[model samples]
Target: MSNHKDEVEFPKMSFLLMAVTTGFVGGILWSLIGYLCYYFNYSTIEPNILLEPFTVGTWRESWIGIILTIILYGIISIGVALVYYILLKKLNTMWVGIGYGFVLFLVVFLILNPIFPSMKPFLQNDINTLIAAACVYILYGLFIGYSISYEHNEIKYFKEKELKR
Candidate 1:
């Protein structure tokens, strides 16, 4: 006989909220990594520039662009998190998260950049920029993956506590 307790039923609304929280947290990590790369001259690109391409020329010149970029970056991060939550929820581990990040790097730097005109410039960037971008994406993935798994565990823990009460 299986000795496992019944799986806890996670609430959909809370799950969604948790996903958003994780996404934003991941986005912040990504942004911090970008700044570090920029500081080291490894890359001059930033989330503000990528998320708000319309403001590319004046992105670093104003606060409005920075705000818009942060907001848009958060939304993009949330979208990525949603994809993980919906499609890859069953595969959650630190190493798996690292792999996920690498895969995301390939998708953006190799496939999408080559196919999409808007993304072509990203491809044309210097080698250091490319590397930096890959690292940043990987970091974001790591954060997202870890966050999802941790949040799920927390939910399970709470559910078990309730049952014991």
Candidate 2:
């Protein structure tokens, strides 16, 4: 019984640590994927594909761009984590995580991409960008859903055991 009670506490510090770590890792991985596509001349942006084509000479430039992009993505990832946490707090289910992920992608596609001139080119007659966005969002959703569900389950299990006592 005491063990169950202890479990129910679910070390806040640890959960937070895990969430941050997962978010960072997920962000980095997705960024790397995007970078690779860009580096290999597989990017949707015609200017990027032609002007400063991805090559050893442009490696440094690409690195700088990718890193900056990744940082931006990391910020988005943090927001995603926060949203997931909030949804879990309110709904107590992982389904909201999935919806949140889709919403994030939709906003990027419909609002951000269109409004941002730089992003306009990527979406213009480019299937790759769409595919990339889909892939990233799917992975992002999976990561969020898994992380949130895992945490929620752990807490719920602990609470149940505590009640049994």
RMSD of each: 6.6, 6.1
| Off by more than 4 A, model 2 | 1-12, 40-62, 89-98, 121-123
- Candidate 2 lDDT over residue span 1-165, tens digit each: 367556554436566666666677766676677666665656554222222322435543565665655775666677667666655634545466566667777776676554444456434647766776666666677677677668767877888999999
Predicted structure 2: lDDT: 0.61
Q: Each model's TM-score, in the order given?
A: 0.72, 0.66
After best superposition, candidate 2 residue 53: deviation in angstroms?
Answer: 21
Estimate, for each residue in 56-115, the C-alpha lDDT of model 1 and write its tens digit: 465454776666666667778888898888776666588767778889888776766544
- Deviation from native of the Cα of residue 50 in model 2, angstroms: 20
> Model 2 misses residue 80 by how many Å?
1.6
TM-score of structure candidate 2:
0.66
By summed lDDT, the worst window of 10 consecutive residues in model 1 runs over: 47-56
Cα displacement (Å) at residue 93, model 1? 1.1
TM match of model 1 to true structure: 0.72
Pairs that collide, model 2 = none
lDDT of 1 at 70: 65
Identify the candidate with maximal lDDT: 1
